[model samples]
Target chain A: MITIEFIPFSQMSGLSTEQKIKKILKSVKSDKIVLLQGKLKKDEETELIKLTMSMVNEKFHGIEPAIFSPEIKNTGNFLKFLKEKFINMLLSDRQGITLVGPANLIKEIKRDPEKMQLLLDLNVSRRKKK
Target chain B: MLDKIRSALKSLFSGFFKKKKQLKLGLYGPPNGGKTTLANKICKDWLGEEMGSVSNIPHETREIKIKEQILIKSGNKQLTFNLVDTPGIATRIDYEDFVKAGLDEEEAKTRAKEATKGVIDSIKWLDSVDAVVVVLDATKDPLNQVNITILGNLQAKKIPVLIVGNKIDLKRADIKKIENTFPQYKVVGISAKYGTSVEDFYTELFNLVKP
Candidate 1:
């Protein structure tokens, strides 16, 4: 059977985004498939990549990260919108779901925009296990 | 002699890197955004089958669902891919919210727990996908947190993305606003529940996955 480790972002509320990302990186190092419940903040997501790239070495494989979130809802009157926009200009409040895994373990990531599906290349993974 | 051997090896190995056999297409959006409905429509149209069940409740698809090997044709163009219908992604999953949606306390909590895990699973599956279709309700505002997060993440990963403005059959559907919000992407409006402009969706989709 296939195994995937689920990591809900909510559960890590006590930790800073950076700390959570560190945990994800550690999980990927172990070849554990990690699913993040909430999406990473823009800066946090960027930092995660920077850290991953800097940390990758002969002992560690690179990570593959993907995120999904719900649709954005536009609401309220002009003044309320302006207030939110002004605040948003200074603070990044974007959030969603994110997942990370070992790049070497996952051979290929194929996406079909029309059908909205994500297919994996399992052959390479099986081959590597041997 | 070395240069000749290197050129020979390059040519011989080139065939091994031929076009991919199948693509992974992921359906993503907020809860109750008609992702499953769209998944069903695609399956019905090509595979002559239904992918999954749908309901009025939110997060109806609490687990990641897959329908493999769908080959869609448009004129001489042929596209083959696997369909991945992910659980609705939410910033928050409150058990009380599920209770309000009509589940009992225990069941609501259970569902909320499962839905929460489902969200994680969907996000995790992202690294395994090649492209994504962001399904949005055409009648709703397109500037919410979840939508922004999805877009930002895809941009970071450099993954090809297409936006689906679903539920156009509804009177309040505003495809233009969605288009304006994400001027960078190809946003196609359709009603997955009623099959409106789905052909155009397919066309746009074909263009989206092109290498």
Candidate 2:
């Protein structure tokens, strides 16, 4: 069976960077795909990848993370650009969605400006046979 | 306040008097993307030496390797920089995969451990690089998360980037697809192994590190 867990930004608002990563890793290790409400900071993403690498074992391979956000185009309008920047600062977490899942389960995650496609390897029985 | 003024003046004078520092050019991409091959080619072309060994297996480069003082000249123009060859970045590393590639169990586990450390090191080195050449396999799909994450991070840092579509000797190689996928950045196609179009790559390098 597969499970998906949604974690809102508020749930991680007060946690330290390490703590947030641990919380996400705990869920991924349990074979649950986490649907985070917003994107992680760039450094946070790097730290998460580093931490995930340390936890890889036979049963737990790693995590595949992807972020989907609206594209910020260059309209060449100064006022509009400033307005967008102001909005981004005000609601950073609400700007995008992040998906993180166990690498063994999620085969690939492809994204473009329009949409994201997640491919899964559902051959559990074959995997068990191996 | 006095210290701040002193530091400001120091920087002002250094900018005018200091010799130009060598640019650090980083080679980054997914595993088995011919990064080492290109590194070897570049090193051999100029220094008559190879940067590191290449293998058919993934994660062959489990540490960052640097080849310093590589100089390339084109007519009256010349550029010199330190070449940084980083391990292939991957979201997953399983020892079983290594075993399947004909490694013993113990060796596979050890390789997996080293590969993880390599990934961490690659991420940390991003802060130190002045420019980057993002090498990609021309035969593979270019829309994967690893490529996106690498490019996004470079964009966020405002680092100058030149994407290389490598392995174009193969029949399935499609450099045009990579070009369309990343229209914002400059893309060059070259077969690092056969030395095809490598001259163009060197020409692009001159523009990549333009001051």
Candidate 3:
């Protein structure tokens, strides 16, 4: 079975950076793929990488990270916010909602609607093999 | 079909024997040290196009930008290489710092996250590079930990490196200090923005990457 969980930006604010990473690690360790909205803060992400690298060993398939920018919502005229719009357009490939989890559990990732669509496909393919 | 197969076999044999002539050169440095500026100057002079955008804001290039197959000529010598311009390497990345630079809290956090990833990506790219140009701000102290870490890593890998003291046009710029700090390596100073002494930089790079 493929499991995907989305952690919103607001939900992460209450936890300390270390606690937040530990929480993410717990999910990843349990074979649950995490789709984090707005991405992790820099320090937290660094700490997570350090923890992963230190604990890496047999049975821990390496982490796979993928980022995809979700479409932004705004109510301003396209002409007025042209610069912001252009930056956002360019950033579509640069920044995004980041996903991280064990590689064995995820077959592929696509940056589109149903961000977890690949997981469902993986589950189907695995069932077919069985 | 028989002739095609024979020619293909011949080319495959030639590929195995031919030495790679183009080097994969990386431009690595601390944030705001003008890596992209140097990349732009080199690209403009040779390829007639820019590699990527540049900004006064730190970590503006939060991605690995590449320009391929640039050929540089100096005297009777010629060097052809693929250039990789990496994000500035920093010891610390803070979202609050971005907020101070006039970005909103959410935007600051996003930028910080991307910048951090860029740093890691740059470090990983070191493995694939044939040589490196370690760019430094001529106005800053060259004895800092970040510079040392980068040099130590490059040295450990046994990769050839050329130290560049960029931004020589600034009033506070000092190339002699950089030369004194790293006496073992050849140091060339240049104003990447104005393209000053860039020919010397290219000549030194060709010499450093010589097989």
Best by DockQ: 2
Which 10 consecutive positions of candidate 3 chain B have the poorest summed lDDT?
A: B143-152
Give the number of the best model, judged by TM-score. 2
Ranking of models by DockQ: 2, 1, 3
CA shift at B41, candidate 2, in angstroms? Answer: 0.6
TM-score of 1: 0.64
| Alpha carbon deviation, residue A115, candidate 3 (Å) | 53
Q: Report the poorest 10 consecutive residues by lDDT, candidate 1 chain B.
A: B13-22
How well is each residue in A33-90 modelled by candidate 3, as lDDT tens digits? 8877765544445456545544443345335555444544465776746766787766
User: Model 1 has how many clashing residue pairs?
Assistant: 23
Worst 10 residues of 2 chain A by lDDT: A121-130
Regions more than 4 Å wrong, model 2: A72-90, A125-130, B1-13, B16-20
Return the top candidate by lDDT. 2
Tell me the lDDT of model 2 at A26. 96
lDDT of each: 0.77, 0.90, 0.76
Task: Give stretches of model 3 more than 4 Å off.
Answer: A1-130, B1-18
- RMSD (CA, Å), candidate 1 to true, equals 15.7
